[model samples]
Target: LLYALLHLSGFEDVSMEEVKNFRQWGSKTPGHPEFGHTAGVDATTGPLGQGISTATGFAQAERFLAAKYNREGFNIFDHYTYVICGDGDLMEGVSSEAASYAGLQKLDK
Candidate 1:
């Protein structure tokens, strides 16, 4: 469903055909997202909370880079990290810890 939505929303990296072949060998779609394996996949999320944790890490890195390089009127590293998580992800200790750190670091944006 997520892939379908992304494709419908004009995310060229995702395709309905790939969604159909999901979990098949040599297919762009996999059981879990693999960053380098697929063009639009930013992180590998085989584990329940891995996506949330990885998103937090990406947000933190963006924040750090922005702080170091952003100018008063030029926000070079300005971007948003969007994460889709479920109750299972919230149940994980790693997700809790990563969420806490993201909150503390003001990475909500």
Candidate 2:
């Protein structure tokens, strides 16, 4: 599911081996969706709510980079952040906490 999303996001050059090897062998996707370890992943997340929480960071970073580097015509660093949080996200307190934090930070986009 995630691989398809990455492909749709224009990560055409991404590969399965790269995704599987993002983290050390022992890790389950290295505890989450690791952006740093994978070629096209946007963040490393786990513990249910972590994925959405990290999305906020990635979105903020995207905005920061766009504002810092994009010129009047050049719109580099502009992209949307997406997350498919599971049922567990709402059941867990940490998930609510992350959601609250995102809301408090005004990360609407």
Candidate 3:
């Protein structure tokens, strides 16, 4: 569903057939989404809180880059980081810690 959504939303790299073959051996889709391994997967998310935590890190990096390089009128680093997490993710301690840090940094995503 997530991959489908991404594809429908214009992420052309997302393959529906790969997602259909999810978890199968030798398939592009794995048991969990791997960032570089999968075409459109943004993060590895086998563990409950891993995705959110990784997204927080990505958001921090974006903020740092924007602060260091973005000009007043020419916004070079103007991307947003988004994360989708479930109840299990919210229950994890790692998620709590990551969320706290993101909140402190004022990460909108």
Q: Estimate each model's TM-score.
A: 0.86, 0.62, 0.84
lDDT of 3 by residue, 1-109 (tens): 6676666777656567766877789877676777787566777788899888999999999889998999999899999888888899999999999999999989984
Clashes of each: 0, 3, 0
lDDT of each: 0.83, 0.68, 0.81
Which runs of model 2 end up more than 4 angstroms from their true locations?
4-39
Assess candidate 2 and give its lDDT: 0.68
| Model 1 steric clash total | 0
Judged by TM-score, which candidate is best? 1
- The Cα RMSD in angstroms, rounded to one decimal, for candidate 2 relative to the true structure is 4.3
What residue pairs clash in candidate 2, if any at all?
33-43, 33-44, 33-45
How large is the C-alpha RMSD of every model relative to the true structure?
Answer: 1.7, 4.3, 1.8
Model 1: per-residue lDDT, tens digit, 19-80?
88888998777777777877767777877888888998899899899989999999999999
lDDT for position 62 in model 3: 88
